[model samples]
Target: MIKPTERRVGYGVAMGYGVTDLFGGGAFAIIGTWLLFFYTTYCGLTVLEASSIFAIARVIDAILSPIMGYITDNFGNTWLGRKFGRRRFFLLLSSPLMFLYALLWLTDMNYWYYLGTYLSIELLSAMVLVPWETLAAEMTNRYEERSRLAGVRMIFSQLGGFLAVSVPGLIMQFTGKDNPFTYTLTGLIFSCVFCLAVFTTWRCTWEAKDVQPEHKFKAEVQRSSGLFNHLKYLILDLISSFRIRAFRLHIIIYIASFTAMDVFGAVFTYYVIYCLGKDAAAVSAWSSVGAFAAIPGTYAFMMLLNKLNLTPSSALRLAYSSIFFVLAFLFIVYYTKTPVPDMVFFGLFILNGVARAGLIYIPWNIYSFIPDIDEMVTQQRREGIFAGVMVLTRKSTVAIAILIIGMVLEEAGFVKGNGIQPESALYAIVTLMTLGTAVLLAISFYVTYPFKLTRETHKVLLKEIARRKLGGKAEDCDAPTRLVIKQLTGYEYDEVWGGEATRRVVGQVNCSRVE
Candidate 1:
């Protein structure tokens, strides 16, 4: 029988744990949507200058993301880790530091000042997010409970996107859109939200018990060496995650799916305003409604996975299909000059909204189980490293997608800060928004076919890991469990959980700790 306290992820725990998405989702939404406009209009920076700031900061943060992951993974060996826990400590530290995000919106800042502030906020976000992301896996082992946690998290994330889109517009209504002070005030409000959300997460969430002393000692020994050696080992450790077959597939799907969204996001406004000859206010209204619509969509996806017992991959295909249909409908209506009603457009946005929630939900929901798979091979928990790598890949791929979109538009004779565009530019916008998105979704859909992780298989994998941890031999595995292990890890039954495969992968770290 399950103990009463075993299921600590009640509604309160899930709410507290998920609330951090207010910052996680809102901060990015605000920055991505408004920062460039704010810099160019009020801060007296050119488009190139503003874009360069983001590029420089993102490049710097991409490097730090995995290092922060590696640090937290081994941090259990430290005095601070012993006292406060490895992951939540960063949440506590970053709570107050979130206020620095406000500085990025302040006007009259020089280029260097903007760069410094933007870099600071990005680094601060990574420091907290990389560790905080590992908490769901650390807190619970049940598939349903973890799904609940991730589902709530995505809902809040959608809400954050809503607030990010709406709050600034509300502030502008009172303060006037042209005033720089409006953005500064908006930043202060969001900073407060971020601070409170992170603090609540720290207070309400808890980490797992410490790992084995031997593992901790080995981590300490590696850190005790020269900085160069420590860096080398960290690099090796980060790369080692790719050796896990499931993670490799997960990353591919993640990159392809999200990059598709990025391309669509970058081009959609252009498609609406330029291609369809709609107003900016209409686009903003559509975006706000879409954001709000995602809340229910997220909940519905949770049901699809939890109640309906749909695999994440199947759910993902459904989402991609919905989005694919939306894009196609929009393209067809515009190309054929169909007299579509406004309500119909609104309905399409609602459908797209629902689909996007799955796009955000499934990969992350599936992510909570990945550490269990990793534990089966290494006999250790390494959620931090995987989180770090995911963040890094996310940032890098998004940057590339945005860059490609910009280049393609520019090549099509698009001009910045101009109300009108050439005919070719409009065509380019529709093509990227429709065909480009469809292509990426196609890639993701194809990749998902080979993916075998589902609710049922996850249970099997977890059972095997538990059995092995309790000193069961791999040789004694049942045929069904053995097949599942081989399918998931691409390792023979006897080659996992500290077997020959472990030595082969572990030996990549040429340190005395393991030898």
Candidate 2:
């Protein structure tokens, strides 16, 4: 029987764990919403030139995220991690690094300097975020609880987006357009907020007990080593991670799905300003409603996943299908010049909002579960590796996507600081917004459809992971069978408690579901 204390997490801990999303969402939104425009208009670079600079930084991510994940996962297995907290140790340092945001919005920096600044922020964020994201897997092994954690994080992520879109727009309204100081000031303010949330979370929670490897492996890892050795391990860790079948498929499909988002988010304000021929107020109204709509949409997705009892791949396909249908219809209406009433326009934003919820939370919630699969293979908890790849891939795609969007704008003859764009540019904007979005979403669906990992398979995987963690040998079950077929290998003793066998047989174990 599960003890009461074992089953429930404190509200403070849960909320604190979640509040970091406010920082992540807000910071990313600020960059996503306006950084490109800032480059084009304020920094005096052409769209193509600015995009080139953004693309350069993506090269850095090829090394950055995986390294951090390797460090964090190993660190959690080390003495320092055991004493001071694995994930929490890094988080403590991450908050103060928020001050670095100031440099990003600084003026008089040349393109090279700007590239360095952009990369610096990316480095700092990875230091904190790779570990932070891994916490979802560590914090709980329960499915619905993981969903709740993802929900809380996404709701705040939307709030962060809300602030990034609305507040900055409101401030810039008074300060006038492309006022450089406006960005500097916004950076400092949100930087403070990000730091505070991170520190507050650190104060409220402790790291969950991550499973450690046997002594020989642990000792070799803990020996302070040179950079070359570290790089070797990172490469090995990555190789180990890619061995998981579902992860490879998931990453490819996720990239395709997220490209649509990167393009749409990069284009939203531009579309409103140019295609819709509207102002900041209109953009704010649309963004605010959309962000607010995501909160309800998150729970709505949770309910759908629960009630339909769909497999992850199936649920993902359905979600992407909804997005495709909406964007496709919106394109047809706009392209053909159907007289869209104000209500219809707002309703489309509402639908977009709901889709955004799935896009943000569903894939991420799935990330926590994937570590279980990796753990089954390596016999070590490696949430950081999987989480790192997810972030790394997502970040890489955003870089390519933003550059692509910028190039598209330049090709269409977009001009900066001019309220009006040419008819071709305007046409390009609407077409990209509608049909471009539809095609990408459809691609995501097709990418996801062939995968396995059904819902029933996932439950059995969780049970098998629990069995192993409890010191019961699993006989290295077949990956495709998902632990339903068990060969007797050997026995495992409870490492922490130093007790008798938690189990010798794989026959039914009584594990209760905790909320």
Among these predictions, the greatest TM-score belongs to 1
Q: Give the TM-score of candidate 1.
A: 0.92
lDDT of each: 0.82, 0.70
TM-score of each: 0.92, 0.84
- Candidate 2 residue runs with Cα over 4 Å from true position: 1-7, 77-80, 106-109, 176-182, 209-226, 307-310, 466-515
Number of colliding residue pairs in each model: 0, 0
The alpha-carbon root-mean-square deviation between model 2 and the true structure, to one decimal in Å, is 6.9
Residues 2-85, candidate 1, lDDT per residue (tens digit)? 432265688788999999999988898777666766776678775556666777787778889999998998787788887888
Q: After superposition, how far is residue 116 of candidate 1 from its true place, in Å?
A: 2.7
Assess candidate 1 and give its lDDT. 0.82
lDDT of 2 by residue, 414-490 (tens): 99767899988888887777777777777767756656554566677666556655555334544644323121111
Model 1 clash tally, residue pairs: 0
